[model samples]
Target: MNLELVTVLVLALIFVLATARSVNLGVLALVAAFGVGAAAGLSTDEVFAGFPVDLFVALTGLTFLFGFAQRNGTIDLLLRAGLRLVRGRVALAPWIFFALTGALMSVGAIFAIAVVAPLAVPFARRYRIDQLMMGMMVVHGGMAGAFSPLSVYGLFVNSFLAGDDLGGSRLGLFLASFVFNTAIALVVFLTMGGRFLLGRTEDLAGAPASEAEAPGQTSGQASAQTSAQTSAQTSGIDLYQGVTLLGLAVMAVGTAAFGLDIGVLSLSAAAVLALMRPDDARVCLANVSWSTVVLVGGVLTYIAVLEAAGTVEWASGGIAALGVPLVAALLLCYLAGIVSALASSIGTIGVALAIAAPMLESGELGAVGFVAALSISATVVDVSPFSTNGALVLANVDAEHRDDFYRRMLVYAGLVVGLAPLAAWTFSLLPV
Candidate 1:
């Protein structure tokens, strides 16, 4: 076979192997990169040059900084503070969780669901809300804020666009994702028993004070303790948390206002925080998502090798030959959505955009809109029970209803997979 066909087949093989073996796609891609690079007569330096240093630092730094916030109880504190705003209104609980998850994901999408799912699942059961609805909202919330300029997903796409000189708007992509996901969340809320929760209030006075303090406490005592803890949490912020918040604000302003490098700023902020609490820093360091870091690095490195081998141009040439830009765009969207449902959304995104690069360069489609459509198409499917976010929700559910929840999630995911790409295309790409 020719080099182009061989490269394409190898890429497909990598995905298939990774999915079937549950191996990190990045690792598989890295290996493929070396093999392909050799066959293409590329040098060692050229092969190594594909490693995405900027993306690596960004992923590592952001995850490392957030690890501090998570381990220091700041994230939980923020969640409780947001929950307090509901004031025992059961209807607002899902929205509250949704908003909180979005806020967390705006800075970084990693672990946002992991942090919120356990709390949200229990809240749903206690308030008699539909567990499926609550879970869907939380996942949607993460997607909503997932395209912020600072978020992992945002950086991944934006970096690729910028590096390739593909004209696209960072802010536009963010807004598109936020609006589309929020609309989906609204639908989930209304249909998933949200209307029933309206005007219904929970008696927080009788509720457990805290999960930790709930054990071995009488109902009356728990109520009193809950009141005390709520007041304290609301009234005061811990020293470390306050400092972390300040660092976050600084990072935001510096990146948005001064055009500072996000990766550098994140690491700088993390380092400063570490200096203050060496012990906590050590613990948080270990918690960074190294697997994700490796995944991104490996996949992008392979993409670089593909570029060197003329594989991207060859693939895009075929796509462009389809003769209709709109049809090609929709095809790419469906490809991303289908693969992302069962594999890594992050990995799928890199591949999808890489394939679409030449078609986008033709100027027939609006770059920003197409990117948004593609991104939404890829990520919105994370509600599939096969994805990490859906699995987390399933795992947290009560054992009695777990089977039912899984089936419901599966059906909902199927619906999303079938419709979301078309909807995303019609709304985002068709406008162009």
Candidate 2:
């Protein structure tokens, strides 16, 4: 059998074994990557080279920093401040998070999500919001602004087109992504218990102390009372929290404005906080999502092996051989969506656009619309649990709910992989 086919089958087997046996998927993936890499005649160094070290640091650092914040009661303070800004309207919380993340991603998607997910997940827990819904909103919000002129995605697409002399509309691409993601967020809101949040308000301050201590409360009420008590205690920021907040601001500014590496910056900030409070550091370090870090690392490592084995090129070559421009365009959209769900969306965009250049030059497809559709198709699937954005959200979820949330995200990603390409193709490409 061809190396490409062998690698693909190994990947499928890994997924099946992990799911059925309830083993850590990342562990299985690492084993598979080694076996497959050896079978494909890769050296040990080449095999290990695929390990996502940057992602590992980012996940560990972000989780640790935020976990420290939660331990010091800073998260509670921020939550209260957020509630005050929104006038305690619980329903508006998701949208507020969406807008905040979107605005941040207008600078860069990776950095924006890294900054947002840690805070957003804890906020959802505190407010009793749907975790999946909140997570998806944060991801979709990042995609919504990812194609703006100032963003990395937007600059990459535009520069690639200009360099290759493949004509496309910069404005159209940005607007399409923004509008499409916004619409998807609305659907998530309506279907994912968002309506229940309407007309619900929580006291910006803790619930009245007398009411919280009153007897005969249901379990739900008791949970709320406990949460309120915690919030009340942490309402005021102390010295440690002030320093942590400063570190966060510096990390944000350094990453967004100065184009510093987010993983390195986050780790630096986390290290500083850890040094100041060794006790809190021990507890927060225990809270880091090491399982998620392993899972993402192993999957992406195997994906790199697949790329090395020529699986991606093999698939794209087959699509290019179809000879029918429109059908090929649609298939390319699906290919981008599927591969990107498991891999880097930006890398997928470069591949798809490079492959589509011939068709665009022949005037068989509209450059602007096709590029826009393809861009959106590639990115909107970042909600997949395997992707960096989705993995960040999963890593930040409370430990008790992490497993169920991973399953839900996987299912949601499947739905998106099935439909988002078609929808994007219809709306952006078909009309043109």
Model 1 regions more than 4 Å off:
203-235, 427-432
Q: Candidate 2: which pairs clash?
A: none
TM-scores vs. true structure, each candidate: 0.94, 0.64
lDDT of 1 by residue, 1-432 (tens): 789889989989988898889999999999999999999999889999999999999888899899888877777777767767778887887888899889888987478988888778866775678989999999999999999998999999999999899978889999999999999999999998999889988753334213322223354764566667675555568788898888788888888899898889888989998999999999889989888998999999999999999999999999989999889988999999999999999999999899999877878788888999999999999999888888988887877788899999999999999999988886445443
Residue 47 lDDT (model 2): 87
Best by TM-score: 1
* Index of the highest-lDDT prediction: 1
398, model 2: CA deviation in Å? Answer: 16
Q: Lowest summed lDDT over 10 consecutive residues: which window, candidate 2?
A: 207-216
Model 2, 81-107: lDDT tens digits are 655687778888888778767865664
Superposed by TM-score, candidate 1 places the C-alpha of residue 347 at a distance from the truth, in angstroms, of: 0.9
Clashing pairs in 1: none
Residue 426 displacement in candidate 1 (angstroms) = 2.0
